[model samples]
Target: MKIGYGHMGTLTMVVELLLEELGHEPVVPHRPTRQTLALGAKYAPEFACIPFKIVLGTYLECLERGADTLLSGGGYGPCRAGMYGEVHGRILRDLGYNPQVIFLFPPLIKPYHFFKKVSLLKGRCSWFHLARAIRKAWTKLTFLDQMELLSQTKRPRELTRGATSKAFERGLTYLHQAKSLNEIIEAGHAALAELDQVPVDPAADPLKVGIIGEIYVQLEPFANHYIEETLGHLGVEVRRSIYLTSYTRHDVLSTKGDMSSRSLAMPYLNQKIGGHGQNSVGDVIRYAKLGYNGVVQLAPFSCIPEIVAKSLMPYLSKKYGIPVLTLFIDEQTGPTGIQTRLEAFVDLMEQRRAQTREGARMQTGSAV
Candidate 1:
């Protein structure tokens, strides 16, 4: 089957590798075209969520380009993602195509169960096939994951011209090709070389903003109105809490820790907040310690976890002495509004920078 996948950060990487390794023709759909979104805008109900609209555009574009099936994820609980497969299927049917949609929902291991559940998706031949597929996927996933971890570590000291982006490009390339264990190894080695080749700038003042929030909004640049790039253009260095590898790890391994998992934005909120939002708080705190000037928290209009995060951010701001701004988006979100808020945030950061440097100069004068 000619399989088509929706882009979901590094998930696209994993899907492409699996399909190619399994000998299926995998078509990478053109980055959701304007026409595709227009079609989805007309076809989707007025009330459909933003992500559904975006994903629908992806599937529609893939189908037109000759993909015979839809390869995506599965449904779980509370989160709309759990039901995205069904919703997407219904949308496809309403529009007329009933292609095969394979969702790879990773299962969690339990006390009595030896293996986890792959919800709605089954291993082709036996448990052995499933094990091999998973093992192969992990080898690729982990290597790409470690590269990002290394980046955040070096990012603070390495924020000069071309340094961080060079590292990011390398990681993206390796992740783009991470298919099998052998490919994963080769890709990582090559990426490390690229990172080493790029030199960090000595005297660069990069605006360091920490982005924390819901996973979809955080990772999908288009969905977030290209916040990272916009910030970059303004000479601000944007760091995000969402890591492709960390999200995957939590998806497969953190079920045990999930119950105790706290809010991702503000620990003071102390709510499970549901979904990956809870885990993001730890990421935010980590970034604050790493010297981010401020944090901008984005949440879908009705996302409970992020709402909880917003509720507690005042305390986080006080405790950490960092500015925290929350942006709530919904169907009505427009580019102009996002642009305005971003400009304001950047302005605020500029003021903060001036104050810090002024204070430093004052101390120097006093010493002299």
Candidate 2:
């Protein structure tokens, strides 16, 4: 079957690879655009979050492009994301489209159901083939995450403006077109080498910023108005608290780390609170402890969990002595406004750093 899914940064490309490996035609649409956002907002529920609207538009575009099936991730808890697949299916059916909709839930929740769904999508591929395909996809996903983090680190230090971004884009293209394990490895190595070639200032001390927020807004550039790229251009190093691989490890693979988000957040939030609200709190505390200059929280407008996280920002900021900026995004959010806020935030971070250095110098002089 011809399958379609939403545009989520490098994730769409990974899903495309997976579908192709399973012998199905993948109808991936272009990255989320203004037109796509408009179409989705026009059809989605009035109060539905931005991600739902954007994905709905993506699905419509895919269906128009001849996709017979739609695939989406499922959620659990107080987050509304768990209902997205069913709602999207209903909307499509009401609009007279009858494409099959599949929701891939976490395997640990319902192993039999998850495997059954996977078997359906695997089509004629044997179990071993499916395993190989998944391995290749996972490898590509991990590489993409590393590539992004590298770009963020390099962007602020590159001697030439936009040099790191240009190299990063080239690397993404190389990985996107790669079809084999060897090719994937080659693309990764070549990409990393190209990034390493970008001339960087050894003495440049860029402001360090950690981004904590809802997964969709954090990962999807269009949704967050390309906040990471904007920050990078402003000479700030950005670190995201979430990535697909990280999510897979924590949620899908159930790999427990020494410091889980829940444990970190328990002192403050003490409950799941749906979505990444709890994680946001935990991640902010972690960022502060790691000595980041500041933190930015990106949440879809009206997102409850993020709202809760935002509400706690002042407390976190005051106690941790780190600045926090909360941005609520929606269809009405403009790039200009976001740019202005980011510029101001960068300045604030710089001022804080300068004052910190002055204080340390004064203390040393007094001791002497």
Candidate 3:
């Protein structure tokens, strides 16, 4: 049986690796693009968010390519994400496609249920083989995350406009082709070392920006119009607040990292309001204290969690004296407009940095 899954940033790579290792043909559609967005948007309801539309388009492409089974991750909470698998499946059926849907819920909440669902895909692989596949898939995921972080650090400093990005793509290519844990580690190191060779502007002091919001919009460059690359091109350093590794550890393995998000957000947002809303607030507070120059919250239009978090941004900005720019996106979002806003934001950050340094000098003189 052929299996297909929608894109969730690097999660696609993980799913693809797992399916191949189990002796199943993984029918991954081409990466999400404008055409993918248009396809999904064509059939999707007007009110449905961009991610829904994108995933719908993805399944359609996969179905057309001969995939009979669909794999999707499930969520719980007030967030609409929990219903995507069911809703998307119905939409596909109504459109005349009869693909099988397998929605994998969070493993932590219901380990038995989660594994039972996963076991359905065991195909001809033995339990030992399945275990090995899981381990290899996880290794690839973590290595990819690390490579991405390294790219972010190098992007702003690269002397050539697209050098770091080009190297990053090459790194992903290497990782994607690796078949074993040792090979994955070697590929990661080789890729990082290649990035290290990209010429850099040692004197450049780029503005630092932390990205926080719904995981899809934050990680999927196509959805957010490649915001990270744009920021890097503008000589601004970018860091995402969430990555697949951290999410897996905290949510899947039940190993908490920096549980401080709850404590940090308590004053502004006291409870889990579904999705990553609380994390958004907490990330802003944490980044501000860590000396980041600014923060960008990228959320899809009509996203409840982010909308709720956006409401508290003004208060957080005032209290922390940090600038926050929230971009609400959908199929209608244009690259030109996003570029203009990013350029303006970067300029504002530069001005703020200058003013800060000047104030520091003035205070020093006063002390003398």
Strongest candidate by lDDT: 2
lDDT of 1 at 9: 51
Candidate 3 stretches greater than 4 Å from native: 255-258
Per-residue CA lDDT of model 2 for 1-368, tens digit only, reads 99999999889889999999999999987899999999999999989999999999999999999999999888776788888899999999999999999988778777888888998999889999999999999999999999998999999999999899899989989998899999999998888888889999999899999999999999999999989889998989999998889888886666232146678888998888778898899988999999999999999998999999898999999999999999999999889999999999999999999999999999999999
Structure candidate 1, residue pairs in collision: 75-82, 76-82, 264-281
Evaluate model 3: give its TM-score: 0.97
Task: Report lDDT (Cα) of residue 166, candidate 1.
Answer: 71
Worst 10 residues of 1 by lDDT: 111-120
Which of the predicted structures, 2 or 3, would earn the higher TM-score when compared with the native? 2
In angstroms, the error of model 3 at 73 is 0.3
**Ranking by TM-score, best first?**
2, 3, 1
- Local accuracy of candidate 3 as per-residue lDDT tens digits, 1-368: 79988887777878888999998899976789888999999999899989999989989999999999998888776788888889999999999999989988887777887888878988667999999998999888888888888889899999888999899889888888888889987987888788878899899899999999988898888899999999998989999988898888775566233377767988888887777888899999998998999999999999999999999999998899889999999999999999999999999999999999999999999999
Ranking by lDDT: 2, 3, 1
Deviating ranges (above 4 Å) for candidate 1: 109-136, 142-180, 256-267, 280-286, 301-304, 330-336, 360-368
lDDT of every predicted structure (CA atoms): 0.67, 0.91, 0.88
lDDT score of residue 40 within candidate 2: 97
